[model samples]
Target: MEQLKQALTSAPVLILPDPERNYVIEADASDQAVGAVLMQDQGNGLQPIAYLSKKLHGAELNYPIHDKEALAIIIAFKTWRCYLEGRKTTVYTDHCSLKYLKTQPSLSRWQVRWIDFLETHFHYDIVYKPGHKNKADALSRPAHVAAIQIEGMNPLLKGLFTHGYTIDPEIPLAEKRHLLQWDNDIAYRKGSMKIWVPNYPPLRQLLLEEYHDVLYAGHFGSNKTLTGIAKHYFWPHLAKDVQKFVTSCDTCQRMKSSKQKKAGLLQPLPVPEQPWQVVSLDFITGLPPTTSGHDAILVVIDKFSKMGHFIPTHTTAHTEETAQLFVR
Candidate 1:
């Protein structure tokens, strides 16, 4: 054993349980200094499952207090679900903050939903270990092995599910053209002109089944329609529809106010021939008391040279005081 250890000390050694299961992970600076191990119970004996020497990005970072934590919880729950995909298992982490899984008092609405998801899915145990001992499992494997990017599911589907498809061919050609035109206009405006949909059949089906109500809602404005389409569809596609719908809305035209003409058409004022020869004056008010107990500023601008003086004053400054300030 001593000879083998010396021979293998310089090589990357991987420890595994019985030969069937393989786990891959890497450690960051934080976890490298504090090694971790994993132990699995094999009925007759305790097996050394994995060893990690580094930190995983998500677990060790100081994530934000609200939405980020909720995201972390969802990530953790998903990881746990994958770990126990087809069987019951025990999970452990050193993050004691997660101990309040069931009854977290200050969790936001989203976090509560995540907790409910954890409760509904797999049955498992979450044990918190001290940071020093957490190295056994925490350091044994990299943190990202737990990350599974499950895309295309409805955001509300808080559990694992498969993607399903449907088709619709009855949408009118005129409506399709209108949608295409709007898509193109928006794509051009947003500098995403490269986007294309080879066949509109699947999109037609998706819109008809999932987005028909929102699209047909009363005189869909750009912001409202964009928000509606984006909820169920990807942004680029929705941007096109939003651009088209907004451009075609009759009610928007009738109610929209005409934009004011540009002000730059007027000639600029002549430059001051002499500094302090002519002056524009105005009073600034409603300020908090300054160190000098003043709450206003009398602004005097020289009309010729465009220079100005700001004199601070109390609210009670009389006409005589104002005259004195201007002279000063």
Candidate 2:
């Protein structure tokens, strides 16, 4: 009974591939390597059946992320042909562009070749899963992993940035256009190292999300999130956008620690040793005018003895008058 309980507590483990069950492959690619895990759901949730990893070399190392991701899927299908040939297979990738590989209008000679192999051999659907959600991310990195670079820009972000640069009225302003520098497809200010971001809501939102919402970015508050993002990327009202996104974040709202100071716990005051040893004094004003024109009462109390004195005084009494009354 104890052994059965322990086994149930842990997650499902590797299992033999079931020919009847459809296969799920979660694949990811780093700059120099690609990795994929072959899984099958046999009654229990998705369990690993096999894992594949390959190191990129020469020109392969330089292949853009799209090709590398496609290669990862192709290799997985080739390795698991026996189990996945006739069975309907699903490929999950962090690169969103791979989902539309078949319909992409322009393709390089090598990309077409890679696509040809997969199309002829495999019957599968490619789905987009965020990089943080993909399971094979760890297996895809080289021996020395990067510190904090996100996998790659999402397809939506890339498209938005491209279109934004063209239509952004601010970017073409005389002061900025004269200072802008071009590196490949990216635009930068002549003297600044930060990547210039155009005025695009979707692109800005995605950037804000990637820097603040992702696990590595640590759902930080507006100020810190803005600071981290500003280090490498620049746009108008960047801080304002970060503040808005952070304020609206569902996780931040629910999980953020309260900033209010907690009230101090009540503790009993120390007892006085003798009468008049400690005393408190105050004046209560705003009373109705009295017969003698006195409208306030001076209150004095002794700590040790449960005794108080109420002295009549005018609301406008001077400091000297109050002191004389205290002496009296």
Candidate 3:
């Protein structure tokens, strides 16, 4: 083991990637470090082109195992961008979740940003391999260590217990039991805190108030509100419930309106068959008050003849009175 460790740490020769040839990347991450190897397909076997490994620090140190694994891929791609950007590259990772990285739900802010970066910057396919088969796994850890020691329990549990949640039925039985505990009549997921939610209205309202009315929430729109609440809570049809709640918010209705759509195309009223047969009427309000109390103009238009009639009237004129003047 000591000899192997010495050999792995020893400097070695690296091949230059051929632009016209295909490339492959093997990436892996340990609790403290991320490592990857860039390889070119030589007709006989895979030739190592480059090796990368870095210790995790700061916010990156807090990332969950899957994210660390993903970080390894991102780092590898960035380091070898010159060779992999234009050509087809296949990325191999021991973490299976990375295969569906872009489609995973309830992504953290960093995860979303990482996914965006990966999508925009790389043209590649991710392939999943067993930990034992991944070549880069050794580079990320000491050769003496036969297995990677996970840093902590519930690394992915932050914000997961902030709200009430139920174990999804789709979860496998073993995982369901592992993630949830039944106490009294309510079920809870164990993490830094217990996550249990009563299906009652009060709890739902409290969650809505915190997520939709809080200062940090900023009265975000329904989709954003749903995402914010979902980071820590789960319920059946939770998004639909959030949609309904946000849609019914009086504050949102009074202070905000959607600008995503424009008014539909103008439909001009059908041309009238004859002058005065079809008319359009409107009142020009807020004119200067005249001494005779005539401070508004009622304009009537004959749609067929393209002609108009203007009459002066009081701004407070009643509908009945206005109709009588038009009759006269």
> In candidate 2, what are the lDDT values of residues 1-328, reduced to their tens digit?
7976456334456678888889999998876688999998898788888888899899886676568788888788888888888778999987767888889899989779877877777788999875667788778854323333333655665667789889888887824458677665666555443568888777777678877787776797887677556645788778788888999999988998878798899999999999998988899999999898889999999988979999999999999999999889
Worst 10 residues of 2 by lDDT: 142-151
TM-scores across all candidates? 0.30, 0.44, 0.43
Compared with the true structure, what per-residue lDDT tens digits does model 3 show for residues 55-126?
989988667667888889888987888778778889998766688888877898878887788788777899
lDDT of 3 at 74: 83
Error of 2 at 195 (Å): 12
What ranking of all candidate models by TM-score puts the best one first? 2, 3, 1
The models' CA-based lDDT, in order, is: 0.46, 0.78, 0.71
Pairs in clash, predicted candidate 3 = none
What lDDT is reached at residue 319 by model 2?
A: 96
Give the runs in model 3 whose Cα sits over 4 Å from its true position.
1-13, 142-328
Q: What lDDT tens digits, residue by residue, belong to model 1 across residues 1-328?
A: 7977454343234233433343221111222122434444545444444443433365433333223323433454464345434444454544444555676568656667877776777555655543233334333323432221123334532121111111123223423554422331111111121122223444433442232233235444466445434322343355666576576656667877656775667686666678777689899999999987999999999887667789999788999999999998
Candidates 1 and 3: which is better by TM-score? Answer: 3
